[model samples]
Target: MKPINLAAYFLCGSNRESFCDRFPSYFLRIFRSKECPPNEEYLLCGSACPFNCSNPRGPVLCTDDICGEGCYCKSGYLRNDNGTCVTMDQCVGKDEVCGPNEEFLSCGSVCPLTCKQPEPLVCGLACGMGCFCKAGYVRDTANDKCVTPDQCPTEQCLNQNEVYDLCNGNCEPSCDDPEPICTKICKGGCVCAPGLLRNSAGECVSVDKCGNYTDGALSQYMNVINKILHL
Candidate 1:
């Protein structure tokens, strides 16, 4: 403070002017640190929280106030855990991997086809992301494998006169209602075999034998009809 260094002041002013003239280029170089990789784009103001395979939609509300410049995944692509940008189909994880007859899905139906529910109804409107059975195939819970519907284990019925129905109807032919309208819906269960009808005694018999039943002797003829139907 005693004596001002005129030469030092002159040098300081000259250096400050040079720094100010190169400030824009220096700032640009700082932002562009490196070249962006494949499937990525350089942004002047990139999001602090970017989209990833686990979080495809990204953060719902980004509260970061600091603006930064960097390379980010482009549209229709997301960064994986390895920090590599890829499409949804290529963003498979350890759990998202699928086996034969199965495929990975980013948004698949929740109600996938199964042996028990080959013709499953729309369970809900909600969807999920995971591996699911492919078309023309159904999941077999018994073996936890995907197979054709016909490959499902055949259901064995207890009664000899009854047969297993994959898609049964409520309108079973009976002595009272020989011909009833049935709705087309899958109701899997056991039903009387073709050419057989349920009688009043809860026994399956031929159509011709239904008219021969008498009020008092109906129970006695049940054993005979059972033997004939089983044969």
Candidate 2:
């Protein structure tokens, strides 16, 4: 028989001895008491079992989705109260509008397109982690929304490192000698800066964790990459 998932018991109040005993005896002996991250960081209802709180069934690809998926706003949506989707004007007092194939997310200043912060990222709130793309989306710097990458933007696209440095949404046609590789480019798109990869959530992430859609982004590598790229 397939092993029964014991993770459900790990939720805050569900950790009674009766629930703990549900596990096989052999597995129970080595069991440590349940540990919980801060409630705001992970609420059982919103954090686990099939992503997207606003639309539980979610997109077509979410049919077999797993637990604790990276919760993000879908394309054409911006975060509103409690991290759910809302129209552009509803995203606080800011007047940011997401164009087609895009959504408002706090992609910092690096991403060409961005949204206004709903609230400062102080600890006690629901969206303290900030809004990002849905599980299968990627942020497009040019248009500023989550997008399904159909194909590479160009044949002469810049390497990961080069893209990270420049690409402020203005792809110039030509320039002086040694004029950044994207000189003859127009309408620059995001192509994962150095050491970054387009993750399933449609955000640029480190290459190491890109292959695993459910895996969380590693923080140390993020800090290092940010320092190097000045993002």
Candidate 3:
């Protein structure tokens, strides 16, 4: 059998009596190798370790008492099953990384939406500060515009689904409905009836009707008629 490297033995605690007692064969093998020729080629199991104390590889070396703790292979290093180290290609992009909530997918770039809340938001076209897109209004995908709902022109009915007004912005029934005649503000004003005219007392009546004159005007006319007819 080939002799073992003494440095490996020392690092394995062969120098200590308690350790040596457990590894007596290791000491005997090394002692017997002394009688061999000086140039004899001995097979060394672990003495050629690059991390030997004589050629220590910084703080990464693992001796009998020093095992790697909290040591992670660097970005380009691969950890071995036996706690040995090797090099690997560096990880390039964040495509595979994911947030805790996993709500958003990577676009092979920066994370777009905040994964914590991940709620969809309407950007670009917006209404007034207090206003949002009303019902039947949707965000136009082509231009990012917000468009109102499509309406069927039901013959220009008034108030336009309560969306429009008439006569100086005052809401009037049937204002949006198509009519033969347009609206007009009468000089003497008007009541609810058609062909209704305001008499001297501001009461509504038909032209040349009994309620056309005031009480005083009627009395004056009656006096004139009494004189004329001798009544």
Alpha-carbon lDDT, every model: 0.70, 0.38, 0.32
Off by over 4 Å in 2: 1-131, 155-231
Which residue pairs show collisions in model 1? none
**Candidate 3 lDDT tens digits, 170-208:** 212121111124334211111313333334453444433
What tens-digit string does per-residue lDDT give for candidate 2 at 77-156?
A: 44455755554445554423333443344332222222222112333423312345554455554554655543223334
What would the per-residue lDDT of candidate 1 be over residues 51-157, giving only the tens digit for each residue?
67776535668765755677777766778889898887777663444656987565667778887777877668876545678899999879878899999887888
Alpha-carbon runs more than 4 Å astray in model 1: 1-96, 169-171, 212-231
Off by over 4 Å in 3: 1-128, 132-192, 210-231
Lowest-scoring 10 consecutive residues by lDDT in candidate 3? 103-112
Q: After aligning candidate 2 to the native by TM-score, how far in Å is the CA of 18 from where it should be?
A: 38
TM-score for all predictions?
A: 0.50, 0.18, 0.14
Model 3, residue 30: displacement in angstroms?
81
Q: Which predicted model would earn the best lDDT?
A: 1
- For model 2, what is the error of residue 83's alpha carbon versus the real structure, in angstroms, after optimal superposition? 18
Highest TM-score scorer = 1
